[model samples]
Target: EAGVVQSPRYKIIEKKQPVAFWCNPISGHNTLYWYLQNLGQGPELLIRYENEEAVDDSQLPKDRFSAERLKGVDSTLKIQPAELGDSAVYLCASSLRTSVAGELFFGEGSRLTVL
Candidate 1:
């Protein structure tokens, strides 16, 4: 199967503008994920989707960031009114099952630069 795929490998936007990233997880994977990685930091879980439902999103910043896994096949992460502090790499990952049972496959992240 193909690995997770993410688009717009890089983006630059002014503060307060809107930006979006898209992802397509490996076929047959039931778990889709979004992670945020800031400079010099390890990846932080932002959200996890089990099929079409968002099963875990405690770390997601609801006010400015929103995500959806459409039909459990593709996903999108959007940041509206972006802030300079939001500049970071947005990673899309997937697994055959839950984290405990399967290894995660990560895409080449979409890097955002908010000026």
Candidate 2:
């Protein structure tokens, strides 16, 4: 089986611009996750979807960010009017199921640079 796949490994935009990222999780994986990582810090969960349902998204900044996992296969994350502080690495991951210690396979990530 293949691992998660993400497009546009990197992106650069000026503040107040919009950007989007795409991800394709492994087949048969029912759980998908998006994470944001800042320099020198651990990755923080942005949103988690079980199939087409977004089960957890408290950490996601809804004001300027949005995500959708259409049909529970491919997903897209978008940020509008991005701010300078929004620069970070956006990661996509997936697993067969959710568990306290379940292993996750992560993609190379989409690095965003807000100028």
Candidate 3:
């Protein structure tokens, strides 16, 4: 089965610019997540979706960040008017279920660098 897919792999932008990243989850998976991993840190959940519903997004920065999983298959995360502090790896992961114990499969991620 195909694993999660992300594009650009890397991006460099000046502060205040808008940026977007995409993700395609594994086929047959019902749970998808967007996570942020700062250098030397573990991935922190940004948002999670069960099919088309966003089940968890408390960690997302509402003022500047947003995400969506449209049609229950693919997802996109956007950071508008980016800040230098937003530089990090945006990882996309998927699982078969929404349980906490569910194992997640991750993509290479879109690495963003804010200048």
For model 3, residues 1-115, the per-residue Cα lDDT tens digits are: 7889998799999999999999999999999999999999999999999999998899999999999887999999999999999999999999998776689999999999999
lDDT by residue (14-106, candidate 2, tens digit) is: 999999999999999889999999999999999999999999999999999999998999999999989999999999999989966589999
Off by over 4 Å in 1: none
CA shift at 14, candidate 3, in angstroms? 0.7
Candidate 3: segments with Cα more than 4 A from true spot: none
TM-scores of all candidate predictions against the true structure? 0.97, 0.96, 0.97
Task: Please count the clashing residue pairs in each candidate, in the order shown.
Answer: 0, 0, 0
Superposition TM-score, candidate 1 onto the true structure:
0.97
* Worst window of 10 by summed lDDT in candidate 3: 94-103
* RMSD, every candidate, angstroms: 1.0, 1.0, 0.9
Clashing residue pairs in candidate 1 (N, C-alpha, C atoms within 3 angstroms): none
State the lDDT at 39 in candidate 3: 100
Q: What Cα-based lDDT does every candidate model obtain?
A: 0.95, 0.95, 0.95
Q: Alpha carbon lDDT of residue 71, candidate 3?
A: 97
Pairs that clash in candidate 2: none
